[model samples]
Target chain A: MDDLTSDVMFEAFGKTLEEVFEASAEGMFSVICDIDKIKPEESLTIEVSAEDEKTLLYEFLSTLLTESEIKGLFLSRFRMKTERKNNQLIMRGNAFGEKMSPEKGGTVVKGVTYYGFKLEKTENGYRAQVAMDI
Target chain B: MKGKLKKLSEYKWLISKELMKDMRADAIIYANKKLLDEVEEAAVQQLTNVACLPGILEPVLGMPDMHWGYGLPMGAVGAFDKENGVISSGCTGYDINCGVHMLKTDLMEDEVKPKIRELVNCLFANVPCGVGAHSKLRLNSRQLDKVLVTGAGWAVENGFGVKEDLNRLEENGCLKGADPAKISSQAMERGAPQLGTLGAGNHFLEVQIVDQIFDTGAAKVFGITEPGQITVMVHCGSRGLGHQVATDYLKIHESAAKKFGIKLPDPQLVCAPATSKEGMDYLAAMKAAANYAFCNRQIIAHWIRESFSQVFGKKWEEMGMDTIYDVAHNICKLEEHTVRGKKQQVYVHRKGSTRAFPPGHPEVPPLYRDIGQPVLIAGSMGTASYILVGTEKAMSDTFGSSCHGAGRSMSRRASLKKFRGEKIKQELEKAGKALRSTHPKILAEEAPDAYKDIDMVIQSVHGAGISKKVARVIPLGVAKG
Candidate 1:
């Protein structure tokens, strides 16, 4: 959130781009609900393909958000693996979560925004920033 | 950016196209000295950005509550030629038709004040609140499609409220050409369970007291008769569905803008020409989402009526609880307005601004036509809200638009760090206002101090002859989702 717009931006880092993607998912879910309380009693497969790494991350997050709402769940755990195919980047993963309950309270994010969204290489590993409309 | 702002009046400022080479039209900002000082440079840059867009009219107007938003600023208006102008889902905002609806009652404040806590609690329970809350009424996808087309009339037909509500609503509670087919399955799924639910974040249901009346004639026209009168105001919009529509179209327009060869200075301003197939489809879809919002508020209003009746042990009608007016704060409308004495059709995109059509405007409801459309400007929590009447100047100057609320001055993060929810709740209690919320953090996030002084905002618009104050209301109790 900024003085100008209430666009929620969060940063996460990991050793590889896949880890960065997983962390970004966790960060966004954490904004929606207390992830610590979200029991991973059920797991679902996640597959998304986009033009590039940045769009891949965005689509990955957006897919999770839509799936969560439709399934009446609050997702917390994530694991992702990505591979390039021709001009497209495909990512397949599993999202673990439990049903939505007020006990696990937090804000509801509308969607992931490209605003301030970034994925870049670091000396040690990789980092990503995701902005969302809450 | 500072020197570029030419002071046009005590309450108005302008930025000429000379400040930016690509700008096709001038940009105007309505603000007093105090609000002008808080206007962000980026927000001004946003207006200029809109000015540079294809088919933009003479002047891009930013209301008194203007702040930096996605593409155009929130509380900003960008009028474009109907046939050639561009329509931006990103610029119209994610929460489509997020608006304020005011209801006036015959009861006195003293009658309602004593039972304020019970009333607030009843409203909270009756209205499904919180982000995760589901609708009390579950409808299948087909039934939901009816809501997408009928808007508030769906709720009225389904026994939530009466038919009179449709008459008092903006656009009769439904926009034409709202094709449900344009809506995605994901949006439909998201909207299905959340129709009557009030999602969190600045959205609220409040019981208020009309503390003062600024215009007796206009007040009477809107059923705001006496000072100390009891009223109810709701602030919310289309939920996940609307957000999804915007997200979906933002992606569509991203490609559509490229296909149409429309250059955008910012990605958030991605748009399609109004006459393009993509643009029409997005417009049809946006109108559908907006209609969903209208239905959402209407159902909530019915529940509010029931809550009030239960607490008072009287029929809602007996208390003269009538829908005063419902105004959409975020919308894009195809309307006819006179520009330099020439009547032309234009798409007026009021991102977070309210329509304030002057007296005798054809769009104003028959009951309010003589006095002008009722512009309900919501205040930040625990602040004073004003009921204003539209002016001819608004039609001429701002495309018949006014500010939406006490615009936020600080970010949610800053406010949460600076304020505590429990402390704020206790303060409200001390001030004789009842408050309730699902989450404590939301209270902190929406601390009144985080918002601009709404009084100064009203002053600027009133002084600028855009909207005239009618009545001032203060919350007696609040139920926040």
Candidate 2:
């Protein structure tokens, strides 16, 4: 289902909201590079908030890209927590990865586009989707 | 949507607003019959979607290279009354001022062809690329602000390039409205380490050789001499800083649209009135990002000269490494155009389209006034790219706009599945091109055949007179970012 004219989209699923957030980041990082080979040599923290579940997912993923760029790391592993604060949803997480090199990746993920964005809670789990502008 | 189009001429098709009650204006697509068939109905529908916006002038333009994108289709143009019309971050895209910069060298292809691989390898080392890769040059907040305010001029003042290089760029490489205060600190943080570095995914530096010259007079004006003349092309844009600006403004404009009582036909097309505070802020910040992009290219151009000098064992001046032109494709401009014999200022939004103002236009540099501004249409990696001159037809019809490049015909995932990078590399080598990249999949995703035919796209614009061909150049060596 990775069908975009200039990008690739994917669905990340997990058992809970925190797991879903981590899964979303993982999915995006996988598209950016070979996430399996990315070791957790460095660690960085990320904090973002949005109005609702879907918006929170969007913000969290988009924030991960910026955090990665600003910190200069190829983030792969993630741990996230969600809470309601000031009547809005807040997502705070820690992302871990190693420095980037040519061999570790090829496609440079530009940003997370809302072209096919979604966050749905199903019978068994939560599923998040994003279309990255590579 | 295609059924709604009425063929006005060989290259123009009109989609009457009468077909849709909500459309405030008509939409026109500049494509021939064959090219028209290739255009997606969704993209044409998006044109009509643009027509529904308030203050949208008639005939929202879809260039020959039009393709389906997230919001506005790539290669589309929309002009709105500056005072009454709306400004959209989605319309301008996330990459502010993502553009092409071309340099024409006096050296011939015969001498460079033998050292193509060495040149490409040297280029790969000199230019920092890849995702999350830090640039060699680091800018503090204060210096970064100056970069945003002055654009390429900062680069020139820093000795990255000469003073004459400024005149060859659009807006003299700096827009006056750029105010650093309008942007967020997040943008500054994201932009600090990225200046002068080419980011990956579709960005590339190509060493080219002139294959053909059609308009010799315009070619001479651009310093493009006979066939076999050498040139280098740099394609990139404002990196994370531009994205951060677009991200911040998209949220602000979305709320502002509500505050202003503007009805959004599509959420993706969220915009504020051009004069609204949110809109003005976005405009100022967008200009800053565009300036950042201009400065980025100037630095890349200087590095290109350095790389050539290092490889050729000659100073850049000795090799005639003069910039022909550097122009943006994804941008918005405030321009005055005659509408029904009455001149009015409008905000023209070009998404994956280039400004193609004709000869004698005030914006045209003096050296090129007799001819026109050089419009470099970037083809995909290993394909034929064109150098075109702005024309009067574009002025009268499309708000002085022209096609940007050979738009992608296939999806990235599909291309990666269909074309093996190793095989493509071999084929390009067979055709005398030396290709280099971080990984082979980068090659696969940007496979030359995955893009539409540059020849056909150029023919449509040339035949329509929106832009006329000056010279055609093919890649001899490419270092993909």
| Docking level for model 1 | medium
| Candidate 2 Cα misplacement greater than 4 A, ranges | none
**iRMSD in angstroms, per model:** 1.7, 1.5
Per-candidate TM vs. native?
Answer: 0.98, 0.98
Clashing pairs in 1: none
lDDT of 1 at B478: 91
Instruction: For candidate 1, write residues B121-159 as lDDT tens digits.
Output: 999899988868878989898899999998998999999
Residue-level lDDT of model 1, residues A1-134, one tens digit each, is 33335556788999998899888889998878889989999888989999988888889999898888888888899888888899989999899998887557577788788877789989978889877877
The 10-residue segment of model 1 chain B with minimum total lDDT is B407-416
Residues B134-157 of candidate 2: C-alpha lDDT, one tens digit per residue: 688989999999999999999999
User: Candidate 1 — number of clashing residue pairs?
Assistant: 0
* lDDT, each prediction: 0.89, 0.89
